[model samples]
Target: MQLKGKRVLITGGTRGIGRCMIQELIDQGVSHIGIIARDKKSLKELSEGYPEVKFIRIAGDVANIDILREAAARIEDKWGYLDVLINNAGIVSAGPTEELLDEDIYDQVAVNYTAILLLTKYCIPLLKNAEESAILNISSGLGLIGMPFYSVYGSTKAAVRQFSDSMRRELAPFNISVTCSFPTATDTDMMQKFEGVEMDTPEYVAKKSIEGLVNKELHVIFGGEQRIKDVEMNFSDPKKFDAQVAKTYDQFKQSSEGHKAM
Candidate 1:
């Protein structure tokens, strides 16, 4: 969808890819941009920087259905409708499944999957009102191929990918496009926590996302083309894919440790 003068709502817009996308949308002449994030201080700072843009900063946890409902109400009250909804809030916790805490698993699922489900349900009415609407879901290469130590995170993203696909079919009658963006390691704070991982910049991912929206692409894979190919190849054999991912995870962990020593 053309972003010019569109009303967009981005969740988790405090930092990383969300922040980059918000700025990019503004640069594209999107006038009404609503950002939902837990960091009030950072939202305040962002509002101060872009005083001309219509920056609606609602500080709340996306995991809470009540908070999401409230945010949707505010959006409907302010703009009446939204042209784009970017579900970018996500969290990753690494550990062996046996050792992974239940709370961590729940939090990851809540923020990454459940929250998106709730937000989309609430926003569908608003999106239906727009002349052309789009739902952009931030998934990952891991969503297709499960990586060891990141199984929980990967599973959540996998759900997002499938959810977006289903929603796309369901919302097609309304002309509300759904774009599932599968990005490889991006140079955001999340990737920084992994240290030596090679990653694309948030700007790069944001650009690809915007391009996908403009072209009305249903699926977008950014960063490593090889990784996307691998995902496609493994779609038929998940067990084999998991084994390969385990090997890659070991190598990545070793590289991260080596970098830390330097």
Candidate 2:
């Protein structure tokens, strides 16, 4: 669907991909934009930067039911319909699943998986009113192939990918498109927590996402050509893929141990 004059709502719109997409959408002439995030300061900053554009800023955590419901109510009250819903808010808690705290698992699942599900359900009514609408779920490359040291985080993202698949098929009758993005390490705060990995810029990921949406691509892989090839290979040969991942994990472990010794 064309973004010009479209009403869009993006969760976690203060930073990273969400923030970049907000700016991109404005540049493309979206008529109404709503931002749901926890940072009032960032929202104010954006609002100031784009003084002529009116962005509905609802400051709250997307994981909370009350906050989500209130945001939904405000959106419905203001525009009565949304042309795009971007489920871009997610939390990643890396490290071994065995060492994961209960809170880590719960919070990751809440923000990454549950929040998207709830927000999508809440906005379906409003979405139905639009001429042609879209829902974009930002998953991760880890979701496509599980690796060592990130089991909990990977599981949550995997859930998101699966949900997007099912939701896309279910919502097809309503003329609403659902697109799931599988991006590799992105240069966001979340990636900062994971040391020594190459990352993609949020702007690049946001641009690719919009391009995929416009093209109606079901699965938008945002990790350049090599990662895309790896994903395809994993899908084509599960046993060989698992062995390769195991070998890589062993090398990473040895490297970490050597660093600690130093």
Candidate 3:
């Protein structure tokens, strides 16, 4: 779908990939862009920088269905229709599943999966009003393959992948495209939480996201060969994929410790 003059809403737009996407949308001639984030200071800064772009900042937890519905109401009030809904808000908690707490699992599922679902549910009506509309869900490569120390996080992303697929088929008749983006570790503050891990920059993801949106691509797998290999391995053998991931996790753990020491 053409982004020019499109009314776009992006969750978690205060920083990282979401922030990059907002700038990219502006570059693509999007005149109205609404950003939902919890940081008022960052929202104020963004509003100051891009005064021409319609920047609406809603500060609240995306996990709260009521909050999301309220945000949707506000969007409906400001703009009668939404051309794009970018479900970019997500969170990660890494640790062995056996050692992971209930809160960790709950937080990841709530933020990564539940929030996206709820937001999409509320935005569908607004999207239906537009001539062309799309929903872009930000998943992860780990979603396709279970990774050690990231069981909860991976599970949530996997759920998003499946949800996107089903929603795409359901929304096809309405011409509202559904796209799922799977980017490998990205160079954001989230990546800093994991030491010594080579990650793609948010700029890379932002560019790919724009490309995918323009092309109306159903699925996007970023991070090049490694990401492709992960998909291949998972399709080849689930058990083998898990075993390989376990081995890689050991190496990553060791590297993380070394980096912490230095």
Query: Stretches of candidate 2 above 4 Å error?
Result: 250-262
Clashes of each: 0, 0, 0
Model 2 global lDDT (CA atoms, 0 to 1): 0.83
lDDT of all predictions: 0.84, 0.83, 0.84
RMSD, candidate 1, Å: 3.1
Per-residue lDDT for 162-209 in model 3, tens only? 999999999999999999999887888776657766788898898898
**Which of the numbered candidates is closest to the native, going by highest TM-score?**
3
Residues 197-232, candidate 2: write the lDDT tens digits: 677899999989988877788999866787877888
Task: Report the poorest 10 consecutive residues by lDDT, candidate 2.
Answer: 253-262
The model with the greater lDDT, 1 or 2, is 1
Error of 3 at 6 (Å): 0.4
Clash-forming residue pairs, model 3: none
